[model samples]
Target: MHKTKKNKKYTGKIYRYTMLVFVISFLILNSFVHWQMQLQKQTKEAKATYTAETMVQRIETYLNQYQTKSVLLKQIVESDENMNMVKFETLADFIIKGNRALRGIELAKDGIVSEVYPVESNAQAIGLDILTYPARKDYAALAKKSGEYVMAGPLELIQGGTGMLLINPVYTVGAASEKSFWGFTILVLDWDTVIEELNLDGLDDSFYHYRIWNMDIRTGKQNLLIEYGDDGLKDELLVSCDMRNDTWYVEIEPVNGWFSTTEFLVNSMICILLSLFFAVLFLQYAIHRQEEFAHHEEMMRAAKEIQEANEVKSRFLFNMSHDLRTPINAVIGFTELLERHSDDEKKVTDYVKKIQLSSNILLSIINHVLEMSRIENGKESLNEDTESVKELIRTIDAVFETTSRQKNITCEYHVDVIHEYAVFDMTKVEEIFLNIMSNAVKYTPEGGHITADVTEVCEKDHKALYRITIQDTGIGMSEEFIPHLFEPFARERTSTESKVLGTGLGMPIVKALVELMGGTVNVESKVGCGTKISVELFFEIADGKRAEESDQKQEISSTEGIENLAGRRILLAEDNPLNAEITVTLLEESGLSVDHAEDGKMCIEMLHQKEAGYYAAILMDIQMPQMDGYQAARAIRKADDAYASIPIIAMTANAFEEDRKLALESGMNDYIAKPIRMEIVLDVLKQWI
Candidate 1:
């Protein structure tokens, strides 16, 4: 009996200990559940806050870009005292086409809305006076008073659209101490489109629903500009941005609301389960932590990549600056020297030669940049014509022979051709050869050998295949550098290369042009040895009839034929006085009678003043005051006057193929891109007149 009693007491003690253990474990589980719930709540709120901040920053950046564009447009308009509507329209079209968020642009002159681009969509808004509109007048008045750009809108438009407007008041500096007010340049911004442009579509529904409201209005009233989601949710995080004179508020709420019955039940269930499955919960938490760590590592790597890319871009820009400035500085400095040493013919000639070389270098850099743009836009096209293979080879040799000889480099050129004539684009051929030979001359050391070997590979279907190999015995390049040699701005940082000046665009342009011409370019180089570049190009052989005709033709031996244009009268219409004077002097020097007009309007008037055939040809500037060259040409073509069929040559600085096409489409007989060479002008005159 005593032994049984002792055993019972021990069993009671064991039961009590087990109960105590259960109580302690249950309390620990409850504590964990509470902590988890608190942590989840904090994390959700934190996430919502961070998302809102990021969205705001993105929106701000997008808005600032538009704002900056608006400011630039304002400057463009205010730059000229007599701001032409056509120019403004063109500028506005370019801007609107490039940016989807911008609906259109409106220009007001003397408080009257005069012009609106994309007239089909915003035609009804044209001629609407901003000073007379009740809703827009206050903002216009404010912009005028401040004489600055002012953000206005989210207001109802009279044209039946709701959007925002950025109004910038323009003022002209007068001869007196006072400034004259010149109406406003307004940018119409589509609000919904802006939200789309900001890419804030799904963010509203994913993390939190938000409402943007403006509280500071002219009428001392609060108004909701835009809203998304749960109206009854009172617990929300509020963020505000100062929009000019208004306080723009964004109120966001968690999708599930702060106090949710589902959340409470989930926490309770989790607390109960934690008592039994604490190990599993710990494992899941550990996995989540590991995922977070990996995400952090990925983010760090991405940041590093971004930094490296930025560094590369910065270096590229720096190199571009150095390259561009070198030629520009040389040109300017040599021109000054020429002006000072005008009396010394030899010194003047040397300075002029240096200036010409510098100018050529500058033009090459510009061409490379423009060519890249054309390639990117898929606008690069080939202009094929019948070319004499011998002449082409001779021209290439002529181009590099002098430079190569000056540098003491033994440059040799060899051409093997089955036919003397082939159909190819001469301009593209010259560009490719010039770039390659220029590089060969620049990179090859003094006394080094450079050989250009050309051979006909094959001929079938009237298409001829040719291979061109340019080998230079100079400090070549490392294997790794060779791979990136054709990349723009790529250069190997070697001691020998440091003294060489280049845009680093030659190989890239050459490769691009070769590929465009349906050819392949390959390079083989080893450091301390040499570099050899090979290109294979295909061309169509000129037909027998054309080849026979070309063979029968002989070169003009004298300028007596071209002298027929010397006594002819020419009409030159240019806006800039300096350019016009220079053109007039050139025409006079060529023994041609020149008539000057300030603009296209004057040109038309001047032509009307003369009889048919009085003026041999009319040189028209495309961008002029009253009427552009295109419109003027069209007007002249439609006229019933004698000069209706008179040859019109477009003279403009626009050097694109599209510009040439447009000029021809506008009834111009010929197109001359400016920085006009006198010889080219004379040639055009000889052809058309």
Candidate 2:
């Protein structure tokens, strides 16, 4: 009877403990569920905020770079006094040059399409009447007629891309208002480069649905141009950027963000788990409630630790990356300075080569970190449009040409398949080509053959498919590792003797770029044999013509074939002593007489001393002491029968929009950015003098 009473007491205690445990578990679980929900909500808002911030930053960066490039170009165009080239020809050259200069803007100079840069694959734009295209001809016409800068709609530039166009008029000296002489200088850029790069850097891959639109707000509804993944996405992120005359909208819908049918099951499982544990405790024996509570507490603590560690690591890496670029920038900039001053041809070449190599290395590191970040986060994809295959191949060849020569390798190039220009990003393609071609040149020994070829595949109606093959008789790869060729950070194990070294992001980037361009890359290799990398792409353009003929031809020789610089009056206004000396040496080599000035005041003094026409052209450096070039030039313009009407060309390194404006406003005609190339200087002199 006493034992029975003891058992009853124990059972009652167990029941009381069980009830207490249920109440504690209920509150804790409820808190956890609420926190998880809040966490998810916060994650979504954070992602959107981050994406928007990053997009805006990149847009601003690209625009600033492009603006700098454009101002430099306009400065050059107006100052070229000796340029006998017609306005049409000038416009042609400027377009091609401008496109090369600007990195990420969708470009269109509506008023004129020059033949120099010509219409390579302008099938989408060449015809179909710009008159009918509201954005192109109409706004461009107004800008040209009005002699002012005009911005157009965020229109679809080609079949694969969205961009904005900027048009500005070119007027004569005495022209009133914006409506003046010469055709318009149109600048167009596809925004996808930075946009997609940002997307690659941000989004996770398994994301079920995403939609991106280059929004046009004409009819109250947003126009979706580039949509990805799905139309079924519920929660979304919308970001706006300044697009031409208006703004661009980018919307992101992550699949993981939305509650799926699978999610309902997950929530059901949670409910079942809670109900089963508590319900069973009531029906069955209630025991060890305290231990179970302690275990749940332990698990939560562990998860918190792991999350904190990961966050710390991410912050560290981001800070390290931020710190890295500063030193790299200094190195690159200083090396450029050294290269310009080095008068020894061989030394100059070697220094330039090293600079290029260093730049490429830095670029590779940046790309690697960026790719890793993107891959880890699951959002790396390509949004490629048509690019010049010829330009890409030529750049690759040029990059390795000197290296190949040093190794005594015969670098043969052939284009059989690339009949028409297709869509792709030049920067990404350049990176891929650099990686591959650099490897080829690095690994191949003397007398080895390295051939680059582009050929055709089976074609469909009116569109011809093409394949680009780069085959190198360098140290070959093993057959065992062909599958992992496209994988990140995997260098071929078999090519052990190959001196070529890389961050292993090369092939992966190439693969990504190819996929982005809507293509495939296949590698075939044998031990002790050679490696063949075949990249296949789709290409078609109406009236398509291959660029192989011209691009593959002899490159523009760097040396200016001038007889003499002696007796040729020259003006030099420069602040940097090293550059000035180098310029003097280069000019002396061409036998040119040179005059020097420290600032605009001195230049004006030099001009005043001479009677009518003293110097061929005043090389007025932009930034200087005691009446800067701009102010001095203005004074020269306002000279009362004293200062000569000399052809004053700006010769400074201040390459920016405002700089160009101030330079032009000060009465100087031409402007040149620093880190001066001798060829550009010579050409400038020849054109003016």
In terms of lDDT, model 2 sits at 0.60
Query: Residue 324 in candidate 1 has what lDDT?
Result: 54
CA lDDT of 312 in candidate 2?
A: 90
After best superposition, candidate 2 residue 385: deviation in angstroms? 19
Give the best candidate by lDDT.
1
Q: Output the lDDT of residue 189, model 2.
A: 58
Candidate 1: list runs displaced more than 4 Å.
1-369, 494-498, 543-568, 575-593, 623-647, 657-670, 675-689
Considering every candidate listed, which one attains the maximal TM-score? 1
Instruction: Give the Cα lDDT of each candidate.
Output: 0.76, 0.60
Which lDDT value does model 2 have at 196?
60
Q: What is the lDDT of candidate 1?
A: 0.76
Count of backbone clashes for each model?
A: 0, 32
Lowest-lDDT window of 10 residues in candidate 1? 553-562
